[model samples]
Target: MKIAICCRKGSFSDYWLTYCEENGISYKKVDAYQSDIMKQIEDCDAFMWHFSHLDYKDKVFAKQLLYSIEASGKPVFPNFKTVWHFDDKLGQKYLFESIKAPLVTSYAFYTKQEALLWANKASFPKVFKLRGGAGSTNVKLVDTRKEAVSLISRAFSRGFSAYDPLASLKDRWRDYRSGKCPFFVLLKSFFRLFIVSSAIKLLPLEKGYVYFQDFIPNNDTDTRIVVIGDKIIGERRGVRNGDFRASGSHILLPDASKVDMRCVQLAYNVSQKLGLQIGVFDFVHDKDNPLLVEVSYGTDPDYTECEGYWNEKLQFTSAPINLPKMIIESFIQNSSN
Candidate 1:
């Protein structure tokens, strides 16, 4: 059997190529962007691509291509359910609720008047977020009815750009202070502040609709649990000073004990039910109740401090696990069976 991989210079593809080569797995590197991508993949049984959220061209059609390939009967890593909500929190709001998952109370409005009306009656300190973004980059805290109203006006007016240079600078500073990044990283972030808009802005303003979540107070950290097949790796990201968002706290560890078992149970159950090959779920809690924040298909494992992993049966092991290899092998095994 042969497989085709959508090759990029860096990213998971690097590990994929190395694994396939070492295992004597027959594979070809194919570009999923070209006009003849369909014909190009005709010779392979599966395709894999670590499509990114920061690429303009990729944002435009990566999922479309992946879906098309799946529709054509070839397997893909992010087959529909796994990816349809990749960068879209709005879509996820509906999905989580539909699945009866314990998502933080959230509201979405498609009109300014509706948003304003809700703002009048809604409580303060709601967490405002754009539909797409990671690391708490676009997440904001709306502390009062007035603040919510003002945001509603702006959201419906020229709309808000998905990219915030000033926020980027603050994040860089936070990482530096936390010793997670260096001085040069701050310099790069400063330079990027003036260079140009991020590819995320190609998304346009998130006007016409506003989304807010009930802020869970005193949440100093958020738990991140990643599940691939039966292996699970999890982390806890501490929030920045006085901030409620934890996804980009510049801290991570793989100590499962630090994570609430309830959250892990929710992530594992939901991901398994969805038939997701992989899922990285964010969560925070109130007292002992863990609440889900968001879910994604990817996370940077390089810096994570996972001491071990858990299996589908909830058994823990101290052995170092290989996610990229697991991803590729699953495709092969699923096909043969």
Candidate 2:
């Protein structure tokens, strides 16, 4: 079958193209941004595009485009089931609850009055997050009622920007101090303080709602398990120094021994129930039970590297594998059926 792939330089498309070339798979490169994208891929049996939440253009129409294409009965790597809640935490909250999945206790309120009422009654140290944002970008710990009220006010008033330049700079500086990044990278982040990103500028402010997750305490690290088709890979990410957020801390423990297979099995079962082709689930413990913190369909390809992967039966297989190749093969198999 002929396949159409939208190539983004550093995205999964690069590996996908390499796999196509090596395997002699019939494929055509098409740009998803083009107005005639559908016509371009009309002859192909499947389409694949690695759209990013941080991209201005993709945020506008990627999901709509993918939904339309899939509705037409042609296959896509990330279909509607896989990505309807891709970058939306609010959507995921409702979805997890509906499915009775082991999600952390969360609350969302659209009205200022409702949010204020809840804040007044809720316990301290709730985790506040903007519906959108990855890598702990818009996440904050609300330790007092006053802080929660202030956040509610901002959510109903001027609103929060999708990008926080000051926070970004601080994170970059921390990384540089820890020798995780170079000085040049830190310098660039400093300059970015004055100049806002075009993507963030084009996006409207996040307002009109507040989301909070009940803080589960005493966890120094969180587990990230990624399920691609039948394979599961996992790692533990340590929280930043003096911080509770671990998603972007970059302090990773790649030892498979540290990964809890129970989390892997939970992710696998949830993915199956959701009919997802790809899922990356982050888990924080509620005492002994693994409660899901968040879910996403995309992650950095570099982070997928592990000593091995687990099968559906929770059996570990020590082998080097290409994730992008696995994704394409799964798509092909699905399309053929």
Candidate 3:
């Protein structure tokens, strides 16, 4: 039973490779980007690829390819249910609402007139976000109706770039101030202002639709939970100073005592119900009740601060959390079952 693995640098692939090597798991490295990708995986019993939202190529075809492979009766790491909504907030709004999950109140408008009408009546300080983007790339806070209307106008007109140089520069400066990045790294962010990436150039502008979520105030941090099979690990990330977003803040508080078990349980249940091999959910509180913000099948695999994992019964175990290993194991077990 050989597993087909696509190894992308900085993705879960490196850890997957290491785990397979150390445990003597049968595996072969295949490139998903190649034209002969399907043929390369034909001999393998299973396929795994850490397809990313940031990659324009992956955004275009990774889900299509994975779904096709799964339909052929071979197991894949993230099957259809897991990745269909990977980088799509618009999709998540529908999915979470359909499941009756406690998702933050969200609204999406397809046409300029519809969006303007909603914006005029909606409450201020809503969180605006594009359908695709991680680390708060295309996210903004619409503090007033005027701002919302302007955003709606832009969304239906010229649209928005997938990459925002000014916002990115601010993020870089924050990192520099927090000592998370070197001064040289901060300097490189300036280059992005003048030079757009080829991949970003290929990505079409996000337009036509405008999505907003009801802003839950007074929360300085958000909890991020990662669930694979029955094991759960999480961290509370502080929001950037003077900012409302927390996902990419890099300020981690890994104390298990601080984690709300309810969110953990909800995460596990949602993942199980969705038949996800691996799920990463971000949550914020709406007056003490945890409301899911968004979810993804793949995330930055680094969880060095994770003290351990919690079981389905909310039982915590003091063991190192290796997400890639657990994900592959879960995939194999589910496939066999």
Candidate 4:
């Protein structure tokens, strides 16, 4: 079967293409940006592109291309269900609620009056997040009503940038200071201060609505479990020093013991119920129980988690698993069947 792998340089597609070559699977590297992209895949049975949240151009058109292809009965890597809510926290909130999944309690307001009304009466220490972005880049803590009210005004006014330069700088410094990054990495941040990339500059501000979730306190880390077909991979991320957020806290190593087995089961069930083929669901807990924080199609460092995996039966397999291969092969398998 012929496949078209959207080749974003150095991305999962790189390995996907390599795997195809190594295994003698028929494939072609296609640039999804080309206007004739549809024509590019005419002879292909499937397409696999790992579209990201940062690219404005990508956010605007990646799914459009994929869904359009899907309408033609061609199989896509994310398919429809796997990526319907990618990079959209607001969409995820409702999907979880609709599915009766154990998502962290979240609220959103689209109107100035509505947001202000909620802000005035709502409790503080809520987790404020822009609908887009990964790595906790858009997530923050709203500790007071006044702070929340100000946020609402901006949400209705000019809005927030999906990329926050100051926040980015702070995160870089934090990572460096925490020994999470080397000295050269810190220099890169300084360079970034003056020379921001086109991707950041091109992204328009995020507005139209504001979303907040109850800040589940005492969570020093967040657990991420990735389910690829019937196989699952898990990891725990320790929060930054004195920080309650763990979603982007770069200090994580694969440790099966640190994960709550219940989370594994819940992830399996939720993904199954949603008809999801591949997903990475994040979880954080209060004192008593674990709460779902977020879900996404891909994690920035999903490859770093070359560790343990679990099958659908809750059986553990401590061998190395290549998730990117699984993701690509799943698309091909579905198409062939």
Candidate 5:
């Protein structure tokens, strides 16, 4: 069987190509952006593309392409089950509610009046977020009714940009101060503030709706568990200093001892129930019970160093697992079957 991979530098494609070559697997590179992309992949039995949420081009047509191929009986790495809700917090809320998953309580309002009414009655200190954005980029803390009202007004008015330059600069500065990133990276962020990213320019503004989640206080860290096939790996991410967001904080603890097995079991069960080949679940605790904050099919592969992985039975095994390889192998196996 042959596979067609949409190659992108710095994405999972790099590892997938290496794995294919080393394993003597039949594969070819195809540009998902090409007008005749479907025709280009006609010779392959399966397709894989690590399409990213941050890419405007991918956001425009990646799902369309993948779902079309899937409907044609060609297995894809991230099938619809795994990616329909990706980078869409609003969609995730509905999906989790439908599936009865242990998701954090969230609210979404499409009208300004509705959002204002809810804000006035709802408790303060809620977590505000855009429908799309990863790594806490479009997230904020609404500490007062006034703040919520202001946000609501803006949501219905000028709306929020898909990319926040000031927030990006602040995040880069935080990383530089924390020694997580180089000074040059921080410098680039400053310049970014003056320039609009192509992705942001191409994407539409986020407006006409407001989303908020109940704040679960006293949590200094959150868990991120990635379920790829039967292998589960996780790490704890500490919230940034003076900030409530843990994702993209770059503080990762890969100790298996620190990982809660219940989260592993929950992620595994959730993946199984959703028929997902791969899922990255972010969990925060309310008391001792873990609630899913969000789910995605992609993450920074270099963000953590895992000691090992947990099997389907929640059994920890010391082994080095290549996530990209697992994704490709799963697609190949499914195609063969």
Candidate 6:
């Protein structure tokens, strides 16, 4: 059977194409943004698109398009359940609660009055977040009720932008200092202060609702577990220098022995229950207990650096991980069935 893939450069589609060509799998490249995207995939047995939340166009209709394709009884890489909550933290709050997962305590309020009332009584040092954004964008630590109230007021007023130039610059500087990126990359970030992209300009302001999660303190690093079918790969990311967040901190501590199996198991269990084709879970620790910060269906596809991967039984094997291959293999197998 043939497969339809939306081939964006540097996306998971890159690996998918490589794997397909190397293994002699029949596939065609189609632009999901086109008006006749559905018709283009009509002959394919399955469709795959690594839609980005940061892109205004993808944000507008990726989920709807994927959901529509899956509804037609054809297997897609990320079906309805996997993608509906892809980048939505508000939806994730309810989803984790409904499934009784070990999600960090989260709160979402639709009204300024309700948010203010809760902020007044809620403890300090809560983590404020917008509904969207990856790599720690739109995330903040509200250390006091006043700070929470200010954020709440702003959320209901002009709202928060999908892009923050200052914060982006700060992050780029950190990466530069840590040698994770080149000077040119850092320079580009500095230039961003004056020139915002048209995509960011097209994005609607995030407003009317404010979300917060109880801050889990004393954790210097966080773990990310990514499950592709029954195979799991993970890594530990150190928090930014003198900062509380870790997701975007390019600090990679590549020690498979340090990988927490509990977090791995939790990621697998949740993914299996939801029938997700792929799942990426970020976790922080509260003492000995691992608490989930958030989850997504799409993340960086490269897992070659991971020393090994764990099986569904939590058995670790020292082998390189190829997440894109696993995803395509699983997709083809299921579609064939």
Candidate 2 — number of clashing residue pairs? 0
Q: How accurate is candidate 4 locally (lDDT)?
A: 0.84
**Stretches of candidate 2 exceeding 4 Å from the true structure:** none
Deviation from native of the Cα of residue 15 in model 4, angstroms: 0.9
Q: Given candidate 3, what's the lDDT at residue 70?
A: 91
Tens-digit lDDT string for candidate 3 (134-242): 8888889889999999999999999998888899899989988988878887888989899888987988789989999999998999999999988999889999888
Off by over 4 Å in 5: none
Please report, in order, the local distance difference test score of every candidate based on alpha carbons.
Answer: 0.82, 0.90, 0.90, 0.84, 0.89, 0.90
Compose the digit string of candidate 2's lDDT tens values, residues 141-243.
8899999999999999999999888988888887788788789989989998888767679987899999999999989999999898888888898987778
Q: For model 6, what is the error of residue 186's alpha carbon versus the real structure, in angstroms, after optimal superposition?
A: 1.3
Q: What C-alpha lDDT, on a 0 to 100 scale, does residue 250 get in candidate 2?
A: 88
lDDT measured at residue 64 in model 3 versus the true structure, 0 to 100: 95
Compose the digit string of candidate 4's lDDT tens values, residues 224-278.
8888778888888888996777776777857888788889999999999988878
Off by over 4 Å in 6: none
Candidate 1 lDDT over residue span 1-337, tens digit each: 7788888766678888999899899889998879999999899988888888767788889999999999999988678888999989999999999999999999999988888889888878899998988878789988889888888898888887777888989888988887887899899889877787546556666677889999999788889888887877777887777567778776665666777877777899999988888898988887779998899986663523577788887787876656677677776777667
In model 1, which range of ten residues has the least summed lDDT? 298-307
TM-score for all models, in order of appearance: 0.95, 0.98, 0.98, 0.96, 0.98, 0.98
Looking at candidate 6, what is the lDDT of residue 251? 79
What is model 3's C-alpha RMSD? 1.0
Clashes of 5: 0
TM-score of 5: 0.98
Per-candidate clashes come to 2, 0, 0, 0, 0, 0
Deviation from native of the Cα of residue 187 in model 3, angstroms: 1.3
In model 1, pairs of residues that clash are 254-305, 254-306
Worst 10 residues of 6 by lDDT: 297-306
TM-score of candidate 2 relative to the true fold: 0.98
